[model samples]
Target: MPISHIEHYNLRAERSMLETLRDFYVTVVGLQVGYRPLSSYGYWLYAGERALLHLSEARPGDPREPHLRSTFDHVAFACTDLPACEAHLRNHGIDYRYAEVPATGQRQLFFSDPAGNGIELNFAATPDS
Candidate 1:
């Protein structure tokens, strides 16, 4: 079958960083912490009813470095309330870059989580935005 859409992305890190990243996604990114059916020690972050991101505890000696450049560039989410989202980022002292698509006029906010995973928040073109 042909691909439809992304189901979710998992971020594996140390427990401390995993918790911190969870809080960042919840508070700053506005995703909700949701139920995970599996027995693994981790969290499922939801955008509405769908879990868009998963956070898992890293195994011992797992050398996945967040800061180091990787082939994966970023993960993007279709979002709304651009102003409020920007305010949340600023209030948390998180740095982000803002842009607007020339063709569609969609507004976008770009930033990274504590684990250095790039995140893009997109707001559809609107008069209020």
Candidate 2:
């Protein structure tokens, strides 16, 4: 069978930084936790389905480090109610850039995640439907 959607994502972060990251994902992003297994440090964060975020504990020898340039440029998600979405962002003090996809007349806004990962919120336009 063809794959339906992305199952989850795994990120490596320092043990001391996991809590801050977790709070952002759970509180700000609005993803709920499912389960977490015992681990030496870090944790696995689930959002309704299987674990969506698997945070690995950083080791002394681990070479990976968070960098401003290394973050993903953007990720997009559809919004049924554009006005509500924009208001929500504003209520949270998040900055965003708006635009229109010329030919399709689709509206979109680009914003950043707590970790600085770019995100795009989009909505299809209709005349009077």
Residue 26 shift from truth in candidate 2, angstroms: 2.5
Error of 2 at 45 (Å): 4.4
Model 1 whole-model lDDT (C-alpha atoms): 0.88
lDDT of 2 by residue, 1-129 (tens): 999997667666676566777776676555666566765676677645657677677778874455478636775666667788788778878789999998988999897765566767778987852
lDDT of 2 at 26: 70
Error of 2 at 38 (Å): 6.3
lDDT (CA) per prediction: 0.88, 0.71
Q: TM-scores for all candidates? A: 0.93, 0.68
lDDT of 1 by residue, 47-103 (tens): 889999999988888856667788877899998788788887899999999998999
Model 2 TM-score, 2 decimals: 0.68
